[model samples]
Target: MEPWEMREWYADYLDACNRHDFDAIRSFVAPGVRRAHLPGGADAWVSDMADLFHAFPDWRWRRIQLVVEDDRLAAHLRGSGTHLGVFRGVAPTRRHANVAQFAMYRVTNGRIAEFSGSADEVELLAQLTGTDR
Candidate 1:
């Protein structure tokens, strides 16, 4: 896909995420795609996302910027959500946290073939726990 087309596709994916449409999300990822922290590949990745929904039912992400080259995409996103369930061993604080995330993905035939990257978990923890770090 051209860079513009990739961006459009990625924007639609983000729309799916913001909508918490897991079924739609599945279509964007190739079956058995690997992720370091999660096993079961694409299913696990989607499950992890479900876990996040449980923790923060209103979680939403907004794109800060995106860069695409060939089949690779780099995304910078800002997210915000209200904690409603346990996550990362932290009990619900009923707090809202805003965080930045950076993710890199490789798309093949329009499905994500590889996914990697992270969000500001430390900062999120600090905000939720009400502690200086």
Candidate 2:
């Protein structure tokens, strides 16, 4: 797919996320999708997303920026949510958190084939733990 097409597809995927439509989200993923920095496979991806929603029922992500080159897309995302359930073994703090993430995705045959990203885990953990660090 062209860069423009990929961007359009990405926008739709983001829309699916905003709606918490797991099936729609999975439709954009290739069966062999590999998330190197996290768990691999479509099931794992869905589980991770479900976990996030469980922790923050109102979690949302906004794209701060997006750049596409060939079949690769890079995105700067800002996410906000309220801690209402356990996350990564931390009990709910009921505090709101805003964090940033930088992600890269590789598209193959019009579907997401690979993904890797890094988020502000330190800040998120600090918020949950009520720590300054």
Candidate 3:
């Protein structure tokens, strides 16, 4: 897809995600889509995102920046949400956390083919536990 089209698609995808529109998400992901985490050996990004949204039902991502080149889209996103549920083996603390992530996604046939990213877990943990870091 063209650069403008890719940007537009990503914007829409994020909007759908924020709204928790599963059908829109299904339409955005390729049938063979694969999601991987950065730093290697991490769990699938697709399932991770799903689990994350489940843990923080009010999560919202604010796009800080985005870069599109060839078939790749890189985005810097800042997210904020309340800790209203358990997540990743962590019990509910009912706190709030803010996180920033750098993600790169590859698009094919107008759908996301792959995705990977990194974020600061230390701060997230601190916020969840209401402890200083």
Candidate 4:
């Protein structure tokens, strides 16, 4: 796919994520898609996303920047959500949080084949835990 096409595809994928549309999200991923920081296949990634959606029903990803090179794409995003359900053993705080995240994706045959990302976990934890930090 061309660079612009990849960007469009990624934007659509992010929209699916915000909508919590699992079927739409799956359509963009390969059956064997690998997650670098997680152990398991595409199903596992979907499950993880489901859990996240459950915890933060209004979760959204806003693109801050995007860069495409060949079949790889890098995205910097601002993720925000309300704590409406249990997450990581923590009860709902009913507070909202905005965190920065950087994700790397590799596309193969027009489908996402690999994904890895890092978020501001410490800040997220602090917000969830109601800590001053």
Candidate 5:
């Protein structure tokens, strides 16, 4: 896809994420995507996202910047949400947290084939737990 197409595609994907539309998400990710260290596939991907959604019902990811090269896309985003449910052993703190994340993705046949990223979850966790990381 061209850079403009990729940008539009990425924006649509983020829209799906912001909407927490798992069905829509399935359309953008490969069946067996390498989202985690291992290939978890779209179902697993949705399940993981469900977990996050459960913990932060109002979670949102806003695009800060995006760059496209070939079939690869890099996104810088600012994510914000409230700790309303348990997350990775951390009980609900009802605290709001904002974090920065950078994700790199590869697209194949117009679907996300694989992706990896780093998020400031440590900082978010600290903010939620009232402790420094």
Candidate 6:
């Protein structure tokens, strides 16, 4: 796929994520996909996202930046959500937090073949718990 096509595919994928559309997510992932190491990885990625959305049903992704090269795309995003349910083993405290994250993706045949992301885990924990990480 062309770089522009890859960009659009990525945008759509993020849109799906923001909407918590698992069906759309399935449409963009290869069957039997694997993530190298992330503690349950791809399955957990999807499930955790769903869990997050359940906790913060209004969470939204604000694109900070995007770069595309060949079949890979890097995206930076800021997400904000209100605490309304359990998250990462913590009960809801009605706190809201904004998190910045970066994701690197490898696309194959217009579908996400591999994805890895990192975020300010310490800050997220601190914001959620009212303590320093």
Per-prediction TM-score: 0.93, 0.94, 0.84, 0.94, 0.94, 0.89
TM-score of 1: 0.93
Root-mean-square deviation of Cα positions for candidate 6 versus the true structure, in angstroms: 1.7
* Over 4 Å off, model 2: none
For each candidate, the alpha-carbon lDDT, in order, equals 0.91, 0.89, 0.80, 0.89, 0.91, 0.81
Summarize candidate 6's per-residue lDDT along 1-133 as a digit string, tens digits: 8888887787898899888898887788765555656643456667767888888888888899999998888999998888889888889979998999988888887677787787776777689899976
- Stretch of 10 with least lDDT, candidate 3: 37-46
* Number of backbone-clashing residue pairs for each candidate, in the order shown: 0, 0, 0, 0, 0, 0
Clashing pairs in 4: none
Give the TM-score (vs. native) of candidate 2.
Answer: 0.94
Sum up the clashes in candidate 1.
0
Instruction: Name model 3 segments beyond 4 Å from true.
Output: 37-47, 131-133
State in Å the error of residue 29, model 1: 0.7
Top of the candidates by lDDT: 5
Candidate 6 weakest ten by summed lDDT? 32-41
Q: Candidate 6: which stretches are off by over 4 Å?
A: 39-42
Please identify model 1 stretches exceeding 4 Å from their true place: none
lDDT-superior candidate, 2 or 5:
5
Q: What is the lDDT of residue 16 in candidate 4?
A: 90
Tell me the deviation in Å of residue 84 in model 6. 0.6
Which digits, one per residue and each the tens of the lDDT, describe model 2 over residues 1-133?
A: 8878888999999889878899998898887789976778888888888988899899899999999998999999998899999999999999999999999999998788999888778888898898997
96 Cα displacement, candidate 3 (Å): 1.3
Q: Between 5 and 6, whose TM-score is larger?
A: 5
For candidate 5, list the clashing residue pairs, or say none: none
Instruction: Tell me how far the alpha carbon of residue 31 in candidate 5 is from the true structure, in angstroms, after superposition.
Output: 0.7
